[model samples]
Target: MTTTYRVTLRNRNGVPLDVAEDEPIYAAALRAGIQLPIACNYGGCITCAAKLITGHVRQPKGTALNRRQSQAGFILLCVARPTCDCVLDVGVESHRGLYQNPFAIAGNRYPPDA
Candidate 1:
């Protein structure tokens, strides 16, 4: 048997959307008709960054956030998969100034050549 978790995302307007733990939070939100701010869908941008108010999540290693940011409860919704019941504060104002272009990195650019 598999256990599924619930995710609650609170937008800037204080609106909350319920999501599932299986898929990426951003995709879940889109299915629910919630438009979450996102630039690169592959964890290359911080546009979809959110703070975990409560609960845990499993994110890809390529997420733009550093160790400190991850430990501080920051998560990129584009790559975040809930591990347990979660509550997230979306559209974090503090993160608005922390944008970094993933493509700017010399070797980390997307669409790697075959």
Candidate 2:
């Protein structure tokens, strides 16, 4: 059995969405009629960047964020999977100035190759 998590989307006004432990938040949000900023679906860009307001997310394949950035509550929803119930502020690609830049990047350029 898969563990399902409830993620409250701030952009959607506290609408609740469910996602399996192994399912990415992006996919789950879409299924719940919620849309988040997204570009490279492979986790190479900040287009799908979001802020983790509370709880935890498993971003094992998300390369757009380094450990420091993740620790700062930043997460790429396109590749983030909820580990437990969480609250997230999505569609935050335009808020770059609010965050400090990371010295190390785990991904390629803006538009990652397929």
Candidate 3:
């Protein structure tokens, strides 16, 4: 059976996104038109790392984050799955003009159907 969790993230703009069930948190942000700075789509790079303000996350592969960071509530969007309804605060500084563009969109943006 497939598992899912609701995820909420606080962006640099202080905007929060309520992502639906079963989707990776990063994927959910992308769907919400939020571009999380990421280098590798995999867990190798920690660039997409974000701080978990509340809730649980499961990282089976554990590639995106080191032990210390994970223990400190840091999660790599590339490999993080919410174990419960969770909230995260973005770690990186968002590009100023990027979000202004209606064009700078997520590569694999697909939101759940209403």
Candidate 4:
């Protein structure tokens, strides 16, 4: 059987979600009728970014985030796959300067300082 992990979206009034280990969070959200901001499905943009508050995830293809930013708990929902139950602050993509996004802190560059 496919393992499914539960994820709670903090911004969704604590709404919970069940996602498969192989499926990305964005896809799962869409399936659940939750519309989250999205841009490039290739994980090359921060359009679907979120902050991983709890649990762990793996985003091998999420290259839009620098090492420091990623280490700070940032996640690209479009590519991130949950490894366990987690909580996330979604809808942060529009808050450009609110969080430590690459363009907001590291300047406007593709590969920002890590």
Give the candidate number with the greatest lDDT: 4
Kindly report which residue stretches of model 4 are placed more than 4 angstroms away from their true locations once superposed: 93-114
Worst 10-residue lDDT window for candidate 2 reads 105-114
**Could you estimate the TM-score for every candidate?**
0.70, 0.77, 0.66, 0.81
Decoy 2 TM-score against native = 0.77
Cα RMSD, model 1: 8.1
lDDT for each candidate structure? 0.72, 0.76, 0.63, 0.83
Looking at model 3, residue 71 earns an lDDT score of: 55
Error of 4 at 105 (Å): 6.6
Tell me model 2's lDDT, rounded to 2 decimals: 0.76
Per-residue error (Å), model 2, residue 8:
0.4
- The residue pairs that clash in candidate 2, if any, are none
The clash numbers for all candidates, in the given order, read 0, 0, 1, 0
Ordered from best to worst TM-score, the candidate numbers read: 4, 2, 1, 3
Q: Candidate 3 residues 87-110, lDDT tens each?
A: 778757422221222254345333
Local error of candidate 2 at 80, Å?
0.5
- True-structure Cα RMSD, model 4: 4.5
Clashes of 4: 0
Q: Residues 15-75, candidate 2, lDDT per residue (tens digit)? A: 9998999999999988887777789997888778888889998776677775555556788
